[model samples]
Target: MEQAEAQAELRRRALDYHAQSPAGKLSVIPSKPCKSQDDLSLAYTPGVAAPVREIAADPEKAYDYTGKGNLVAVVSNGTAVLGLGNVGTLAGKPVMEGKALLFKHFADINAFDIEVQARDAEHLIDVVAAIAPGFGGINLEDIAAPMCFQVEEALQKMLDIPVFHDDQHGTAVIVAAALQNALELQGKVFKGVKVAIVGAGAAGLAIAKMLRALGVEAVYLSDVHGVLHAGRSDLTHWHQPFATAPAHWTLMDMLADADAVIGVSVRGAIPEAALSGLAAKPVIFALANPDPEIDPVAVKRLRPDAIMATGRSDMPNQVNNVLGFPFLFRGALDCRASQINQEMLLAAVDALARLAREPVPEEVQQAYGFSGTDGLSFGPEYFIPKPLDPRLRQWVAGAVSAAARKSGVSRL
Candidate 1:
């Protein structure tokens, strides 16, 4: 009864929080002053024409005259919202607005949340490509898997600006970074560890690709049906590369002897029995939100030696995508990158790993409501840096920008 009342209170507070404002979470405010007649003229009609003409002559001048360099379009089709599943495009506006808020709050990037009524991947691709010129970068969000892969790929090829799917690569980057640090603490090497991922959706597939880039050869992926083995006829192209050869391998078989397990699937997706087969000092990231694959408390009881992370803020080592997307786009937009490539993503991963090892700043400690850096050190409990760490803006973003320049992807 108490739990139910608590949940009801939370629901009421959330609704009130969103409803109390200007009806929604976002607003368009003029960046320039327009109090006087001359200011108005410069802001719009006559004086604006000068810069307009320059922009017309050279499209690159849009960055000089307008807010184009710092603008990002947070595009979503509402096909797959992590916890909510397929909430319609209109229904997904709040989540996108929250993402925009994160961009502004964390990295000072201006983001416009665009909810597109796209019928499929092709439609979303077309809509985003059409509006690509207005944004410095496109942040693909909440679109379902299989389709998300298609949409992101098409937009990346069709548009010159950075087109990133946050559900995929953003989650992948943070997970990779956290896992890298976790592995280092556990005395495991990236190339030597065997990882079993329990979801073959956008996050899972992307995590697999990211880990592969970091030099892990033994990656096993599974969907709802079972482990994605070579004999699975229903496997998509995205799932095939990560498939194991043995046809009859189950989730238990995949978990057996694995050094790490990452769950991007729904709650209760992983059975408690599966933990019995894991290698010693296992690294487990139960990233299913609201509820994890298995309870962290349960994991603690069952395997005291395990290092665990979850998507919940209440948990230590929360594998939050907030740590990745804001600074990533900040760097890409600052550099005017042609696209967000593998090198940039790896740079973010590397930056995050190194940042975790450094001492937590006093500002960061206070931001997370911590009194001091007692538990927030470079250890199993805090392998990933807190999302509120201000250093992330400079460290991760700068590394990404430098890599973009080095990789010859930067237009700046």
Candidate 2:
């Protein structure tokens, strides 16, 4: 098949898959009987008043009387979908459903994706904020940056329930984990490390913020135009935070002598020149999907001591959000988190890092179709744990719940 034909065929199959299962995921079921008059009264009428009154008397009792405690709404405007860019509201549904599926499968949490048909960021945030009272937590996904920052900040400040953007923080959590492991393997530290982050978009910005949160001594970022630096007249509001000594820096300048390079930009931005002069045994997470900024093979060939990770499944050390999200919300819902704070994000990152450091089971290797010969090492090719590692759910969830409790955000 020609390239266009193959692409068309794949799209056709994806549509077929969705059409085969109409109405998307999540269907409400009547747990109480409606077959008899007495059942009707108890389930929907006068008899329901007792529990309703009790719950009204004590807000905390809502967890026992309703699904309020175990449910999450994955809210998004669909301004960003995959790497497809802004495809609008209707186009993002399947991805939302996929999020719902992962939530159920990975953590047994009841999640529904709420797609706001609003044409602007304000409308989406308003809709989510108005409905926030009904859910235990909100998981924001696939919205673009700058605007996403505004929406998350607004919702977090106003809503009592936890609000999170999986793209920003989910990617951050895994990268943090991989970096922690990679650093340990290299006998290096996070502070005093020169970090180059390619891509000024949501994931890139979030990863930078998280690295700063985790105590990175120095940081740099590059957009399509080049590096984000101090007083760069062309820099956007989001890019200003990572600005360095100069007004602007080229991609190669940013990468030279860097201890770590995080590629959240498009494919092939970092040619071999940019990869040169990286610190010995450099940690590289080429996170661009489908194709990373640097070819992994070329990277390893050029720098034998370098550690390599990407967002691709075929590569070792895949830092997929599948490593998180499912279990991250599980903890928030279980704890009845009133808001997703920096505490929750940090907790997930630490838990994920530690979990990635654990020994991989033989079955886990078998599931990945590996020969089971690779020792459990948290380094270049082994920085992240396999998706099938069973302990992920408990480890991530427990830490989030603990953070929620300690942070005074947990109702449980």
1-412 in candidate 1: lDDT tens per residue? 9989988998999999999858778888899999999999988998999999999999999999999899999999888976898999999999999999999999999999999998777878888999999889999999998999999998898888999999999999999999999988888989989999989999999999999999999999988999888888898898888887488887888889889999999999878887777999999999998889988888898988899999999878999999999999999988999999999999999999999999888887777767663636789888999988889999999999999999999998
Give the per-residue Cα lDDT of candidate 2 at 395: 89
lDDT of 2 by residue, 1-412 (tens): 5978987997898778777755566666665669999988988779889888998899878788878787889887888898888898788988998888878777877788888887677888889989977777888998987789889988888888778888998898899878878877888888888888888888988888999999996888888876777767886677777777465456777888888999887788777876668888799888887779888889888988888888988788899998878777788877777876788888888888887767777777778776555655555578777777888888888998899899998876
lDDT of each: 0.91, 0.82
Which ten residues in a row are the worst by lDDT in model 1?
367-376
The CA lDDT at 182 in model 2 is: 86
Clashing pairs in 2: 160-338
RMSD over all Cα atoms, model 2 = 2.4
lDDT of 1: 0.91
lDDT measured at residue 197 in model 2 versus the true structure, 0 to 100: 87
